[model samples]
Target: MMAVDKGARCLVLNGATLGATGSGVLALFSGGHPLSSAALEGLSATAGMASLCRVLLEQAGWEDGPGRIVAVTGPGSFTGLRATLALAQGLALGYSASLCGVTLGQAYRAREGWSEAYCITRARRDRLFMERPDGTVWAGPSGAIALPARAFVVGNGVSMLDLPQHETLIRADCTSPDPRDIYRAACHADDRPSLQPLYIDAPEARLPSQGLRPSPV
Candidate 1:
């Protein structure tokens, strides 16, 4: 069920980072231009995804043909990461279109003039997920994490850090990665990396007690 033409266009999905209201974002693009973008708020990701699909088919003209599907892989929300990736995978498989995953950090770095910057997002409680200027990732309590001198800091976690006068911080919308940047990052991706979810901490579904339990016959 792949698209007849792989290069016709691409549909980008961004739900890896949940907004304050737990809403997800969806956007469609063709030839580097935005066709449609929407926010799925106060609704289940499943429902939101369905609505997005309808928009792509009806408004974006994907009903007649399929196209590439790209989604954001996260160090953010668990449910969002899983749901968006699953949707992308399913669409790629069904339409036989190329599937790609981009990280929030990558999207941030894709912005022009951004040679180096720190991408940070809120993690469990006081902790945060950070992407260093060197592209390495780290996660820990906010108090213990330190930013490199003179580096730019961005994302939801930026507010948590007390920056020195020498450091520059860009406080922007970290709740959702820009779909255009996600597509740009995908275009520049190397090694054709496998699309997989990025998790920074243990999933909330697992309990601490479960880790100590022994298997029983």
Candidate 2:
């Protein structure tokens, strides 16, 4: 678990997990002191995850105050991502703190010994959300438009697609996204977005009918 050091100055929050196929949550605090390592935990949308995170920081002994707080803006859960955004926005607003973020692919880059990496998340059956190593340029909605094939598709989302591995496609098989990947990206951004989530598919539920139709005689 990340803890407050003798003289830390910045705090980083990991919201990029909102894009993973399953629930992934992480947050860290670092300053000019020693090390900030928080015990990462995964939780479904079941209950209290958000409140729990705040409580964790407090228990770890970090003063939540003015400074930089990083958030991830991306292709992720509509509800979870929105909730994280709401929390980050509220924190920034309340503390008058600055905000920034790292995206899914960029987070992967934080891992070691992986150069020429390609990170992706589910966009739609006909498309995929991706980022270049530069971590700034937007590639394609590709499968639906243009842009070359990819080398490796990170995250369990690829399993959901079961795409072929001919000239393109490779499943990541990684369990959890690396925290260092997030820290690196957060370092690059300091004004995180007010994300409006990117859902790969439309909502499954349907609304009630305006009224029932008459039956034939």
Candidate 3:
């Protein structure tokens, strides 16, 4: 599901870093150009991933250079969510493009062609992070949710079991949301997203029980 957007010259993914439970994946899209994308498996990818994205645009055949880039935010990982979000945020800022986000549920909708879908990912405290077509979120690591009647569900934590919500439910494939989808949905998407990571939820270590605080820079 790729399109030649006069809008974008390159793309990048870090599916492995997000570790979306059963949906861990990493992808990079750069119009076959010298794509400036990042997906570091550990400790973030490139030191200046954003700057690279800008450079990639030139290689992407953009004579004026790609003035924009795109990135995928996440709902958290099997381990946690903080790291990924931080990385995404920084990149978005550097590129000076508007930020667009796609929920895992939206990916299912693309795959299943339904009006409603639940994109579930494993979360801490035995819960799942539920992403919906309307961009609504449910905090359930295991329980299922009703599909939006006209949507499809896809992702790791999602399974089509016959429950009350099952009428609206369908098991979804573990497909991460596409940056293109996010671009379409984002009203703020003026251009490429900065190098900022978007974690849909909090990490267990930062939970009340853990009472841990983020380290200072």
lDDT of each: 0.71, 0.53, 0.47
Angstrom error at residue 174, model 3: 3.7
lDDT of 3 by residue, 170-204 (tens): 45444455444443333233433344334556543
Ranking by TM-score: 1, 2, 3
Per-residue alpha-carbon lDDT of candidate 1 for residues 137-185, written as tens digits (9 for 90 to 100) = 8999887786655567767677777636424545555545567777788
Top of the candidates by lDDT:
1
- The alpha-carbon deviation from the true structure for residue 184 of candidate 3, after best TM-score superposition, in angstroms, is 5.4
| Model 1 residue 129 CA deviation in Å | 0.1
TM-score for predicted model 1 compared with the true structure: 0.81
Those runs of model 2 whose alpha carbons end farther than 4 Å from true positions after fitting are: 1-11, 15-21, 32-47, 123-150, 161-171, 192-206, 209-217
Better of 2 and 3 by TM-score: 2
Worst 10 residues of 3 by lDDT: 16-25
The RMSD of every model to the true structure, in order and in angstroms, is 4.3, 6.0, 7.0
Cα lDDT tens digits, model 2, 1-217, are: 5544423435455443433244555455556332344433333541454575567557555565636556655555455566667777777776667776666666676676444555555443445555556654432444332224665556534444443432465556764465566666666655644544434446557555876667899
Please tell me which predicted candidate would have the highest TM-score against the true structure: 1
lDDT of 1 at 93: 77
Residue 121 miss distance in model 2 (angstroms) = 2.2
